[model samples]
Target: MHVLLTGASGVVGRFVLKRLLDDGCRVTILGRRPVEGFETGFCAYDLADLDPQLPPADALVHCALVHAPGKFRGGEGDDPEQFTRLNVDGTRRLFEAACKAGCRAIVFLSSRAVYGDHRRGETFSEADVPTPDTLYGDVKLAGEQALEGLCGPGLNGIVLRATGVYGVSPGLADHKWSGLFKEFAAGVPIEPRKATEVHGEDLAAAVALVLKKTGVLGAPFQVYNVSDLLLDRQELLALYATEAGLSFDGPAASAATPGEMMTDRLRALGWVPGGRDRLKTFVHSLARRGGAGT
Candidate 1:
């Protein structure tokens, strides 16, 4: 399959790109700058531009967005209109361009933020309706709605509401837990916070599954939550401390929340995440990389 991928240089997008390439799919990347080794078939354009002359492809995996730095939740200090134009409007334009380019299937990388802040013990499934509380969530939900509206007889759309994605990327040190690692390494006290997370490789696997499942494309639209682990920052810090041979006496364990972003829908499709084992490996790797030193 020939795939057109946006944000191929991003953390998650890079994983998806590698997975697609390993699966023997021809890929064309659309991005503002050429990826270091993938310049041969690159389209240089910003998502806000709404370029019409997109290259033809059999499918499209859209992972591009304008997110605030280290503050995706209501951190977009840009003009509201511009944010909408770049994300919501930009998504619609891209989908239309994909349709015009004869693409039959599209997979959008949405976010778990659409579920809003879950009350303690609250869990979410694909069956739950979105109640976005932040501008970022609002924009993502809008993009999903756009996909729903655009799906027709010949088009198939899938939205993966992904949770916090964590993994090591070359030359990229500021992953989701980078700050926590640095703080721990510096012996700074850390607070406890709970959240759901998924590995980038697992997310890419979900995308690959959706792309290979032709039957899913026959449906008008589909939405699935992609998450693996429900973790507390304290527990993770303890694990890191053990691996790094450091002392970390942080806050006590917080009450567990029952309401987590569930991945049953994707699991039903035979998708299994890497779970905490991957998390352990990742932490150990980070420790060895001097995340524990200074």
Candidate 2:
């Protein structure tokens, strides 16, 4: 199979690339800068301006996005137009390009953010109407709409609404979770929101499953909530501490009304998730990578 992957250098995209390669798929990566170590075909072009016909493939995975740890800083104050320009407009361009290139499948990397912050005890399902609470969430929902319009009956379009993703990666020192994990491991007092997390490898596998499945996917804009583990902040901290030979210093704070989408739909399709063991493995991998000393 031939596949075109955008954002191949990103955290999730990197794993997707490796899994595709392992499955013997030819991949062409589109990004702003040329990747250094990857030997696959590289196209150094912005998603908004790339010529889709340059390297055609059987499928296109839209994974590019303007993301930072916190709020989007590059945009003007509360002007959602800017967010639409990047996330929605950029996605529209890719969808058009991929369609024109005759790609049979287009997979968009969306987020649970589209569901917004639900009230305590409220859970979102694929059947619920999207209610975006932030500019980021609104923009992602717009992107999903654009992708769906461009993918008519001729193509299979999928949207993966994923939650927080955690795992160890190369250059472990600069990872987002490094400091938090270190604090937990060393028994340093800290407070972290009990939240949901999905391992990168499992996410990659889910995308691959969608790609390899030969069908219309049951819906035009097929949406799936992708999450693996659900743990309170205290439980995660305690697990890390135990792995590092430390015990919980005090009573952990109560878990906030958990914020995560259930993954029942995806699992019904035969996608088994990596649970608590995945988190433990991530910490162990980090420890082996000099994280214990940091």
Candidate 3:
């Protein structure tokens, strides 16, 4: 299968790119600049100006988004208008172009923020209607709808509303929790926090499962929540502190209840995640790497 992947330079996209290649798919990366060592083919097309003239592929994973550096929820910065234009509008255009180019399956990487202001501790699922609070959530939800609008006879779209993604790749140096680990190692007082997280590998697996069953996937548009563990920061950081020979208990467990995003829909597709065990393995690996910050 020929696959076109956007945002291949990003952590999540890297996970997807490596998995697609390992699965024996000929994957081309599309972006402003081609990602080194990862691109089987490179299509440098502006998201704001998508062209159907780009090479065709059996599947396209739309993971690219226009956002402020080092952020996502409030990634618009000082330009919310441009943010919508690029992320939401650009995504819709990309969906159309892929559909016109006869791409059988397109998986859109949406966010868990789409379920804004839900009751505390609610187990959010695909069935719940999105109530985005911030512009970022609104934009991601809009992108999902855009893909949904384009699903039909020749197109099967999948929207994976993912939660906090955590992983590391070779030569990447740092990851999402690297800074937190640094703070903990340096004896900085750690705070208690908890959130749902999924390994990027697992999220990519979900994408692959949806793309694999394209023609026979029954539904033209499907939304799946992709997340694994409901982890507490104290417990997570404690692992690093323990391994690094740093004596610290961190803060008390957070009283704030963390919500869970149900992945049962994706699980029904035979998607299995690396749960708590995976989380421990990742932390341990980082700690063994001469301290996580390094």
Number of the top-ranking candidate, with TM-score as the measure: 3
Tens digits of per-residue lDDT, candidate 3, 1-294, equal 998888888889888888888888999888888777764788887778855456878888989888899999889999999999988778888888777666889999998899984556888978988887888889999998888888888788888899999988534777898888877777778778888889989988887888887777678998889999888888887777776777876877788876688887788879999998898888777767778845
Q: Estimate each model's TM-score.
A: 0.93, 0.89, 0.96
Write the number of the candidate with greater TM-score, choosing between 1 and 3.
3
lDDT tens digits, residues 134-192, model 1?
78899999999999999878888999999888886533556777777777677777776
- Any idea what lDDT model 2 has? 0.74
Measured by TM-score, how close is model 2 to the native structure?
Answer: 0.89
Of 1 and 2, which scores higher on lDDT?
A: 1
At residue 63, give the lDDT of candidate 3. 90
Candidate 1: where is the Cα deviation over 4 Å? 216-218, 256-258, 292-294
lDDT of 2 by residue, 1-294 (tens): 888899787777887787888788888888876555666787665755644444677888877776553343233355556556766777787788888777888888888888877544467788888987777788779888988787667788889998877774432335547677666666667765666678877888888989987364676568889987766777766666666666677336765666668788888778987787777877776556655534
Name the weakest run of 10 consecutive residues (lDDT summed) in model 2: 67-76
| Cα lDDT listed for each candidate | 0.84, 0.74, 0.83
Q: What is candidate 1's CA lDDT for residue 279?
A: 91
Off by over 4 Å in 3: 50-52
Model 2 misses residue 131 by how many Å?
Answer: 0.5
